[model samples]
Target: MSKTGKSKHRFPEFTDADAWEQRRLGEVAEFAKGRGYSKKDICSEGTPIILYGRLYTNYETVINDVDTYTELQENSVLSSGDEVIVPSSGESAEDISRAAFVQNSGVILGGDLNIIKPNETIQSTFLAITLSNGSQQKELSKRAQGKSVVHLHNSDLKVVNLSFPTLPEQERIGAFFQTLDATIASHQRKHSQRRV
Candidate 1:
């Protein structure tokens, strides 16, 4: 708010900081497409797996708790922290490119997903939120192709531009959202329990 009230990341710790820098999604990060797999490959008990389809129906803006597991194969590379999961295919433009942030490693990434690996320029949680931001989602929708199932490729994802603050500011903003999301989930659960 540097006297202009133009919106800035002003924390008491770094009150005199500059505004966030703008960059394309491709500049500070790379979108890696997850490997292919079939339902036949799924198992009742094994290593945890991040299925792309679940990005639509099962996840929130960010995911910290992953409970589903599948059989771990030699090629089933696990996800590392700071990687965001995005659906490659969906029934509509809005559903396409829906995202989730993976906070830890070890869960195997499955087919029809694009993993957003943000580098030092941005935090993974921040990147995830920006990817799912309304303007970005609209861009994704415009880039998405198909008839019944909308599809977004790595090439399509690279064009979305993002404005990010310093690492410290990103850390603060991302952590705040994480805490807020947890609180919202807690309230949602309490509300659901009352309904039951």
Candidate 2:
């Protein structure tokens, strides 16, 4: 037991199984795959966009352009505060577990990415942080399977275990992390300016 009266890595301090709730990813949110867009479809102006290829280890939403699409590409819709994860990639299996929080609106994800939209019960930031943690990353790496190219599916993420507290607690945790992220962003901006 640690100072928090729980294991050094454990969280929320649950007393028993009844104290914690188990829910599928679908139960708390909707998981959808991204659209497959051709190279010609990408434009210099229009709707915001996000491609799994651009997702980094950090949860930064890297936009290549302001292109938009007229037709509704399958599984391309994404709202703000959604969790975007790359389950399939050309990189190593361990690298495909990268996930990010969508802080921008009207952004469409490209194929190779899975978008998870929480159903109001969970905080998007909290979910992103939880998934990015070392423990969860290890679990995700274990579940990822593929011979040539590693891949993960919606069902795989749905069954993954998650720990949570009450809604209020979730909000507090999310806010605390958000502040930390902001601080990091500020420092990054300062460093970039120094390089210029």
lDDT against the true structure, each candidate: 0.77, 0.64
Stretches > 4 Å off in candidate 1: 1-17
Question: Could you give candidate 1's per-residue lDDT for residues 83-189 as a string of tens digits?
Answer: 98888888988888567898878888888888889888788887777678756777888889999888888888887766667787778877887888789889999
Q: Number of clashes in every candidate structure?
A: 0, 1
- In order of appearance, the predictions have TM-scores of 0.87, 0.73
For model 2, what is the alpha-carbon lDDT of residue 162?
65
| lDDT value, residue 77 of candidate 1 | 59
Which ranges of candidate 2 are over 4 A from the true structure? 1-26, 38-40, 57-84
Model 2: worst 10 consecutive residues (lDDT sum): 1-10
lDDT of candidate 1 vs native? 0.77
- Model 1 — TM-score against the truth? 0.87
Model 1, residue pairs in steric clash = none
